[model samples]
Target: MTESATDTTPADQLGSGPGRVLVWFYGVFTVAAASRSIVQMIMDFGKAPLAYVLSAIAACVYGFITYSLVRGGEKARRAALVCCAAELLFVLVVGTWTLADASAFPDATVWSDYGMGYLFIPVVLPVLGMLWLRRAKR
Candidate 1:
């Protein structure tokens, strides 16, 4: 059988081209956030419980987005899109909260100051992921 214009292979759908970069970034962020939170929780949980927990949550979101991108399917695409949106929301809220009240976070979460500590990747990645996922639907 011949392939139609819409008959994109798995690679063409997601986890290819820019999606590959997304996957790589997400994977790295996942590990980074997880490690930071794990170390903080073990070493000084009481010092900044909120910050550590937020970092852990960011790690989970990054992990899920990475998985969905690598999985490469319509379902996975949808899941990634939703997670990306949620991740963006969390970053905005947490970032704003951190800025508004310095005492609220004695330590920085992965998303502190709109991910300023990580060069703002935490804030930018989700927007990029959402755009890429939207294009992938085509």
Candidate 2:
């Protein structure tokens, strides 16, 4: 039996496979969260300034983390780990608070209600990102 270049698996699979998936997911969230934050900030910052700012921060984190993962280097991988930690904290705290006091939001943020509006990608993405970074351990 023989395998072609397309045969990606346990061997000859090339660089960080899981990292690829994480990067893709993070890239999507980067666009989604950044767009949402920008619109919210421009539309009515006075309505939910804090939430919007957090959204932007989250967006930036997602973008940087994605970049770090794709970078495939020691420093970049470590950077991704740090970003993943921050994301996990943000999701947990914001998710809990939003579920507890939706009124405090005044408007939806990416982490609100455990990212229900974003289909919980915020919750799941960090875990995958962390796992991928760990695997990439340069």
Candidate 3:
């Protein structure tokens, strides 16, 4: 048996590089997402179903991202990309709308304040994670 020319032998070096950054971001996101959802769900599940559901979704995505990083491969890479992209979209839309109309968001989601609660790291990390995956795929 032999390897394909398309094999990313060199790229995997990043498994220990700033890809560690991807790992860190995923870790942070996982904790943040989980905590936020847990808090909201416990405090007042009936407050906003849409927002709470989205929060739960975000937590699941974060967990997926974390798992993908720990188990890197083509499939994990794709999963991580999809998760991060969703996070980016979530943050952008939630951030803009929440700021524009404060009345609508009775409480901030994990993506609120442009992820200011997390120093906007949540907003930026996903974009970075996707870039890292693209580079690793190269």
Give the alpha carbon lDDT tens digit for every residue of 30-106 in model 3.
88788888888888988875667677787888888888876777777887888889889988998898899977778
The deviation in Å at residue 20 for candidate 3 is 1.7
Give the range where candidate 2 is weakest over 10 consecutive residues by summed lDDT: 6-15
Candidate 1 per-residue C-alpha lDDT over 1-138 given as tens digits, one digit per residue, 9 for 90 to 100: 988866768545588988989999999999999999999999999999999999999999999999999888888999999999999999999999999998999999999999999999999999999999999988
Clashing pairs in 2: none
Query: What's the number of clashes in each of the models?
Result: 0, 0, 0
TM-scores for the candidates: 0.92, 0.85, 0.83
lDDT of each candidate versus the true structure: 0.94, 0.81, 0.79
lDDT of 3: 0.79
- Candidate 1 vs candidate 2, TM-score winner: 1
- Scored by lDDT, model 2 comes in at 0.81
Q: Among these predicted structures, which one has the highest lDDT?
A: 1
Residue ranges of candidate 3 with Cα displaced over 4 Å: 1-15
lDDT (tens digit, per residue) of candidate 2 on 89-119? 9999999998898788998889998889988
Give the better candidate number (1 or 3) by lDDT. Answer: 1
Question: lDDT at 80 for candidate 3?
Answer: 80
Better of 2 and 3 by lDDT: 2
Off by over 4 Å in 1: 1-12
Candidate No. with top TM-score: 1
